[model samples]
Target: MPQFSLYEEEYHPSPLKRTWIEFRNSHIAVVGLVVLAGLLLFSLFAPFLAPYDPLAQNIDGLLIPPSWTVNGSISHLFGTDALGRDVFSRIIYGCRVTLGSSILLVLLAMLIGVTIGTVAGVMQGVRSSVINHLLDALMAIPTLLIAIIIVAIVGTGLVNSMWAITLALIPQFIHHTRSFVRAEMKKEYILASRLDGATNRQLFFNSILPNMIEMLVVQGTLALSIAVIDISALGFLNLGAQPPLPELGAILADGLDVAYLAPWNVALPGLTIFVMVLAINIVGDGLRSALRKRLVR
Candidate 1:
């Protein structure tokens, strides 16, 4: 029994031991997850914790250096924008816009892209041929440029902007998801499951989707980062998040003019964009690294 116990221990790890080993091997991934979680928590609690009304004007406090000075105050730690809105307050609120738009855009794009990609990748013959040609044409056009053009034509508002960005992202998602699905479809287990009387839905849910989940996770993270950055670029170009919404990109673009002096005006938004995008990218990197290690082990 003692010898058997040792053998069992070697053959099967306790859950805690498995988790500890995972943690030790994926330290950077853990840090990324922590940063991502922290930012998400901050965004969720912004309304309750913000010091001043993000939209309220305080010309008296405009662009004040962070307090602890004779004339300065701490109410607005990040200072104020041109209209005297509390920069700190607005920044906290600004995240709502950035993160919300990012999530919405990523989700919408993923749904459309993944569905099409699956259909295309699974079908061989005229179905895939037609889909592949269309995707190729769209891929040939520059995503950002096409996004800007579409936004300009459709008129600029949140809905229109989301549509434009979603359009920009659709091709990439289709390409990636199609490739992933196609590859998974060819795997022996998938073919075996199909031969063993699995329904289409079951094949997708139990076989294909489960296998592609890790790749999809990585794709979604990377896609969100790209979508957010693309949306911000459109905003900077004055196409998305039109005036009065406190968009991070427009704030930074406006900040560029006065960048010589009140650098924080732009810096605040720029930093927010940077950190949000950076958090997403970090998460993506971590996922990729973890997945690779998983493959190795």
Candidate 2:
């Protein structure tokens, strides 16, 4: 062992630093991060990046193939849709709608779920049991079916679709959080805090919440992928984004009619959705691994 002087100190990595280091070390995670960041930047700058208005119709250019194809123009690089909107431009703009709604849905679900789950976990007796049973019943239903039912009840639209998806997802977060909280409640440190006159609120806010951050982050990211899929599925079903809006799934749906003549229209949006969901899942997995290692250290 090395002798330490009064001024000497042992080094320990901060949480942020460790997290970054771990994330950077994961190749899949790094790639996912880069792709996601690029998409976010592209979405943010869609108005500037897109050469043409995504919604603008060019009737003369309808069914045009990609730029490299015989009848295609460089102006519509990824080709034109049935309505003659530039596929590339629509894709760029659609990113904002798809990612934005998914993120908002996740945030809402997390806020509501975590609060209810924590309360259910902390409280004793019949209330907790009732809450648990309710959550379990919700979870037993397929998320897509639940979303469809909610959407049917509330009517169809982008906002309503997201709300439906959010409702479907809440049970998952609540179950996860409740399990973690219940386990944490039985730990020795929690008992000691209680013995030291710490209020339930104080123990929760100060002690429990901090430890739950890693789990929440991982869950939130994984939820994002599912949310994206659900959003796209709803859009595909004509229950989201609607006509003239250029959402990814709606774009793909529109492309179906002219798919044979204009394959790029469908392919581009489908590929974008696939890449987006894949990146999110990869990042989520990386976070889970990296956070677990940090906890071990």
Candidate 3:
């Protein structure tokens, strides 16, 4: 009889592989992932994908309708804006601005918030107490209000507006991370680690942090949806991306002026924002469900 190797006798898939298998089974999640990927790819390659320069003006071709319309031309499929800039090109380029800025803002906020929250959760006494109280106070103020105040202090611009939004989002991450860490601390693994002579730093870095990864990923996705909305709102108010930049919010704001004669100007950008936010949310929900199933297993 042939001897079987131990590895072959007791084969098991890695957690990541298992989680991916489970995630792939969800139809909505799969669709959302596809849409999100398409958007990201389009944004990343906008320069090559766009037919015309988004900023170039054709004064004579201004306010043309979409190509499907009788007066529209194939050269400008989505039509031209008030300044005769290609609407399709601007929309394509705007994806980069909107997604890139929001992603950067989320990352910055996550780094600051997770660091502070983890420390507060692990180290007891006045420090933790103070951090919690500070987060509570910050949370009480509306996110938009906080963003507005920060924008005012930093002065107006696209980069500054992102900074403002990042500041406003930090408290949310801190709160969520703190709560997750505190809950994890009460679990049996933490006590087992302590009894096994594991140092506090070792336990946190090796054990606690690894388990928190899934929760953090879920929270990050959810936060992204909120970031998208806030960034657009700021842009609409003229506190974010400035003129001639082709930002979605700025595009929508400009469209408002010519909405009567060229409704596509307002409709297209507004619809884009709506679809982007919806796709993000659907993915977030699907991730939460998939991760929850993994935890249960």
Off by over 4 Å in 2: 1-8
> Which whole-number lDDT from 0 to 100 does residue 154 have in model 2?
91
lDDT of 3 by residue, 97-213 (tens): 998888888999999998888888887899888898999999999777888899989887899988998999999999988998899889998999899999878987999889878
- The 10 consecutive residues of candidate 1 with the worst lDDT sum are 1-10
> Which regions of candidate 3 are displaced past 4 Å?
1-11
Ranking by TM-score: 2, 3, 1
Residue by residue across 116-218, what tens digits does model 1's lDDT show? 8888888899889888898889989877788888988999876788899898888888998888888888889988988999976788878788667777778
On a 0 to 100 scale, what is the lDDT of residue 12 in model 1?
67
TM-score, one value per model: 0.89, 0.95, 0.93
The prediction achieving the highest lDDT against the true structure is 2
On TM-score, the leading prediction is 2
Runs with alpha carbons beyond 4 Å of true place in candidate 1:
1-7, 10-26, 68-72
lDDT of 2 by residue, 183-203 (tens): 999999999999999998998
CA lDDT, every prediction? 0.78, 0.90, 0.89
lDDT, ranked from best to worst: 2, 3, 1
Winner on TM-score (1 vs 2): 2
